[model samples]
Target chain A: MPHDDHDHPHALLPPEPALRVKALETILTRKGLIDPAALDEIIDTYQNKIGPQNGARVVAKAWADPEFKDSLLNDATSVVAELGYYGRQGEHMVVVENTPGQHNMVVCTLCSCYPWPLLGIPPGWYKSDAYRARAVREPRKVLAEFGVTLPAETSVRVWDSTAEVRYLVLPMQPKGSEGFSEEELAALVTRDSMIGTGLPKVPS
Target chain B: MTRVHDMGGRFGDGPVNPESEDAPVFAEDWHARALAVTLAAGSLGQWNIDISRHARERLSPKDYTRFSYYEKWISALADLLVQSGVLTEEDLRGEADGGEHALANRALKAEAVAGVLASGGPADRPSNVPVEFEIGQEVVTARPAANRLVDGGHTRLPIYAAGARGRILMVHGTHVLPDSSAHRLGEAPEPLYAVAFPASELWANPEHPQDEVVLDLWQSYLEPE
Candidate 1:
């Protein structure tokens, strides 16, 4: 009841979907189909523990160390498992690199099949109708909406995850970041950058 | 079987409104709860991932386009539970089952949740069968008659890519075939390839002629061009 004390509008009535979810949870829990504690753990695991930060570390290491990058580009599943970022939607891994002449973006047109272990749950836009329908057909236009503009000569490669293997775009390291530490580079890796919707932030 | 979920190159959909990079993983509390419950139910091993996906895809076109993402998930989860005999409509309405149903090896406990998730389901399987296609081979996707295949059960073959010619980019090892797997037929591990289809092949006037759409397709979905 105390959680209802909010200043914002729509605070009084829980949305329709919310009530439906609550009812379903109650029914399942009552029927011994699911555990309440396990539910808490699942939420906590994705909500806090597993997220884009794990992927940022992977991207940062790839940029900081060429050897690791080679291994990552070659055998992403084995190398990322070494870093303890493996499981679920990321059972099979493929790291696509972005060069000056080429860019790689990822989408699952059939469904929202994302690399949950590496990048956590996909953003709302990644799962929306527009993204699923348009990303494969007109990736450049979709990228522009995400504030990314590639040159005319820079060919865009849109990866539609129609199968098990998941894709992570390794954005090209920004110029002037030659001497930056891995930690600094990780900070520059945004979730969208890895998803190929936007570029990694340049060192400030 | 070519439902709304197979929408790839259909036109007139609006802009992709991506959220800020730091948006919360779950926009609302119920969304998190819904996802967690669906996943927890999934731990029972009553159905495979492909089966669960097919459940969602099985949504009628009207309901498929109408419901939100989690809404579809929870709705499908309910259907799965009923179909699996894990729950009943009477129980869903809060009526007592009188402890009649026997459920064992079903509880995905709090302690095991982390380990279960970390040791996630792996779809890859060793295959004695020879791979049919190789990288750089010219291939064309299956042009399903009447937009359905595999007895119209469940398929990962999107409609747009069907009949489009492409060159194999990379060959992923044998992986679970969703078409048969979704129907509880068998894993039927098959060689999967990341085929690179030029935008021109899949669309009328693609925004960029040089652009390519690379899709990871199973062997059955493709044939020699």
Candidate 2:
């Protein structure tokens, strides 16, 4: 039941952000404005239930099944919804496939508008000013920084998510991943790969 | 009009320092609380997501960048609470008496959190409005005059893409325009498009001229070229 008493005249604590948040929660709880349990529930949902793994699963499915890939590419909203990953920022989904000749990347230059239902909260770098400005201007260089060096002939198509629609990059399937199971393939798909900042883990 | 949030192609920002893959979802407890409070406040349904975005963008240019991501959320939440008569400065400062107040009618419960998160609020709504443009059509983005750098209010059109010529890759069905929806002006649904601007057009001396940048643009932002 401890709360940061900001009113203390000579308080020792220097008003840390965590303490301030707790103070706000305490006030709201007292005022019957917010439920502490509900707050914990929301925190748990984002922390556990939703995340990059969801997007990775979609990628793995698309990689394993061509029909699913076509459906995802043609109607991402319906396909992604069928998998129970449609919500909020991801109402209208667009799946951009990454081929050998074309590499796709996504960024919300105006603000960090990411597919929360698919990828959870965006990574710090995705929301950072540097990536927002540079991704659209110099995607190839940015890709290289993420250890995603493309061939000279390959084209990097950047999608600046400027509106309500969200994008998911369908990274190229790595060679030798042919016999892998869906779960195994999902494990190989990293969040950055789906964001077009990195590549899928190659089979050893 | 060239709002601080529309930072597409401008340079001299900084470095792109990405976090490692194992980074925790919420860096701190406060980060979680900030999100929870924002969502809880938003559940009241007084304002839509667009309005909430505007609240964040309305922060001073210095303050907008100065605050961390969730810190921006907290500031916007507080701003909306006061603006919507949900709370006052005294309530936020803990100066007001903590009298029992009526809880919001639509307070989200802990049990409903998972359900709500799973079934997100889809923005795609059927509109009888006929489409004005078609796929494969060449179009030019409406360029705001130099003196009027913005569309007068909250807009999804990035200044960098302004005046650029592009081809319509797809004609997305009628969707609510954020510019109007955010301000509560009206639904003002319009046909959105996936406009593909060649790299050469968006940037001079492009590294890969064959590459293109696609943006989800509204019909009002474009004109047949």
Q: How do all models score by TM-score? A: 0.94, 0.92
Candidate number achieving the greatest TM-score relative to the actual structure: 1
The model with the greatest DockQ is 2
lDDT comparing candidate 2 with the true structure: 0.81
Q: Kindly list the per-residue Cα lDDT of model 1 for residues A79-127, writing each as its tens digit.
A: 9999999988889999999998889999999999899999999989999
Per-residue lDDT over B1-225 for candidate 1, one digit per residue giving the tens place of the 0 to 100 score: 466788888788888888887789999998999899999988888889988898787766776798899988887776677666777666655665545246635778899998999988888899876798877899999986122334556787788888889999998999998887887788889898999999999888888878999998888788898
Cα RMSD, model 1:
6.3
**RMSD, model 2, all Cα superposed?**
5.0
The model with the greatest lDDT is 1
**TM-score, model 2, chain B versus true chain B:** 0.92
DockQ of each two-chain model: 0.41, 0.44
- Calculate the i-RMS of every candidate, to one decimal place: 7.4, 6.0
lDDT of 2 by residue, A1-204 (tens): 011222221122224556656666677677777787889998887898889999999999999999999999999999989998888678889999999899999999988999999999888899888899889988987887887788988988899987788999999899999978999999999999999999999988
- Stretches off by above 4 angstroms in model 2 are A1-16, B145-152
